[model samples]
Target: MSGFEVAGVVIGALPLVITALSAYKQGKEVLASLRKFRGLLDGLIHQLQTQKTAFYLDILEHLREAMVPEILQYGDPTEEKCVGILLDAKTGTQMHDYLGPLHEPFLEIFGYYEKYLKEITSQLDYIVRLKDAPKDDLPNIIRASKIQNASLVFKGRLKFTIDRKTLDALVKDLGTERYSLGKLIKRVKTKREWEANEPTSSSTTLTLAFARVRESATLLHKDSLEVPTITVTETCDQLIHATARVQVKSICDDAQHSRNQGRVLALELMSDALGLSEAKHKPHQSYNISTTLADFLRDTAQDEDARMSPLNQTLLALNVVSSVLQLRPTVWCNIPWNSMSIRFPIRLEDDLRIPVCAPYVELAADANLLQSHTCSPKFDHDSCQDDHARDGHSTVGDITSQVHGGLGNKEPTRRHGNIHGPDACCHLLVGVEHEQIIASPCQGD
Candidate 1:
């Protein structure tokens, strides 16, 4: 009722009102800050996505550029016949700079590292289990070799992430920046020096093999911090080169068992595909007797039994792969080639295993097919050879006595396929598309 009482009530409410107003202002500021943060986060995501897009695009572009020089740019069809063509290589400097960007949106490097870590760790664990393992321990030796390989990769990829320039140690008390990479770096350098000092010129294939290994390893190198990719790839490259050298040697020296190791499986795969499954299990004796594709071809030409033998398809498959190698050496370096199918321009009602010189195969002028454009896959199609390509550019050229003579054997099995006429020079074509990744289990070799 009095003025004093009304003033007391107003004063009590005043403090509450001021506190509420302060809280509202603070909440608005927090909300505004959050909005700004969200905007920045979105921008970062967009930028990262753009960078990844560019990275993958660059990879595709690089692949395109590599192929275009070999096959795409050739205006003349005859020039595309790369049976004996040795492709020109890109430069080392250009290769070093190929992966323009390091970061990936897909985060493949993380996965890659995870795989490497698991593998190497497992290997190391295995060695540890064999306490005080001898230097000659087979498994230990294998794992150590892998470690050395990883070490090499670490060197090549040194430029990608951590700057080699910044590895210098700034000793606080000494006030000096000493060059460093700790102990392993010295070991790697010493090993490299030792390798460099070794006599290599005496081995004609050494340079070529090492070059192959380096070029192959470059394909796996990328700018990434997550994966230890370089090491695994380097090891793989080295192993492949070593294996190739050994295999080439075996072939040249006529080391029958060694040379026939993987080729036999490949021959069987081709034979099985060519409706000659019986030859898949053909005794190793057969392969020992015939080592090279030319040997098989010669045998097939001389003997009627050879035409029906698995060697017939085996020769064709080897030739095809050889042809492809002439064009793209890197493609088949790892492929076991367990399965392949070929089709001739001459159509059959069913899929026929028509033989053609493989994409990279180089057949001798004298090594004529017993039968031109001949295959055993029930060549039932009535469509003429001319009808092969939708356009006039025939996908396969007909085999004739003019180019490759017919097996000249009239085995009823060969007669099963409908051969319209064997007049055209058979254009042997492979079924595999270019630039395809064959992830199938090709480690058979």
Candidate 2:
């Protein structure tokens, strides 16, 4: 090789070597930072187990022993004064005259305390739900609990980031409010008044109140407000699961008792159809599924309401027929194969009969709305009339008849155009090619 050429190559290699060394150093620094961050997380998990856990337990203990019993004796948790607590309602404008300027502060304190008490109860309930936890549900519950905690952490972090005064102010407000409640409790006049103030709906009130308590706790804890890393999370979860198994039997028993009493573990809105008429002047219309319908669903072992519990997709369809009918109110003619209304119909009556005849038509789901599921759409090219003729599937004619409830072979004549009348009733009939809708206006006696 030429001497000049070898010299050029050596000179070029110097910058390359330097760059590589710099990249290596940068990578090492990143790894070291990650390790340090991990150590912080480990300490956090330990703190959650030792100090924070005990602190939360202590908070609950004070609330349970001190506040809860007092509120129970008072009846209305919102009541600001002893007289109001005894009365079980608002103290009227008379309160404004007496307490005057202090009334607003009293009311403010009452509201904040109520919210704080609620958070405590919610945190307690969440803990209670997990304490007698099963191995199978522990992982899922932990994940959910983490989500709840994140909300708290965000509030605490906000407080910490802003100023020291926010925390101090909150503490002062809480203390003053608690003292007010204590004084109000002592002002009860008669035994009869106390009895009258008893909580009419204790269970619902308790559940809602506890939810607020957990919310408050998350707002208060600043130092431990950061989200735990996977290592710390898993460690904390392990600790909880280890301690939780002790009361599993009792928790299971409590759960079972709650179930038998028709306890609602949760409630979910099945579809937007539930509140579809909100803008319509006829708000809270007669179209809702009532308690009578719920009774009927239980009485008849029909699997029409697929989302109804136990047989159960936790979310129940509010109304099956109206929902389907509402979606295609304009298309009143062609029964669209791809409409979601067929699957998620608002359930009304227990008389729902699922005809296996028609194939479920799936439309393309847009990503912006929800992630699209792979759909194997069974497309029936036939008109609505022909769609129902298949074996095992109820014919359109039969479905229409069944919907009529044997009122008469005399069906209401199909009417179209803006329906404005005294009493409006609409029935939709799906045929192979089109859905024939019969609308009739009624004259009430």
lDDT of 2 by residue, 157-221 (tens): 10101123433343444434343433432342233255457655554554555565444333333
Per-residue error (Å), model 2, residue 305: 40
Q: Model 1: residues >4 Å from true position, as ranges?
A: 1-39, 65-107, 110-297, 300-445
Worst 10-residue stretch by lDDT in candidate 2? Answer: 153-162
Worst 10 residues of 1 by lDDT: 154-163
Candidate 1 lDDT over 1-445, as tens digits, reads: 1221221222222222223223433444656534544333233223323333332333333334334344345544231122112122332223223322321211233233223223322322222212355422333332343354443322111011211222111112112212111222234346546656886653444455546545533433321122222111112333333333333333333334434563332221221111122344423322111133454355557877546444435445544543332233232243232222121222233453232333323222322322332333323333223344333433222222211122233455644333422211122222222112111111111
Candidate-wise lDDT, in order: 0.30, 0.30
TM-score against native, each model: 0.15, 0.14
Output the TM-score of candidate 1: 0.15
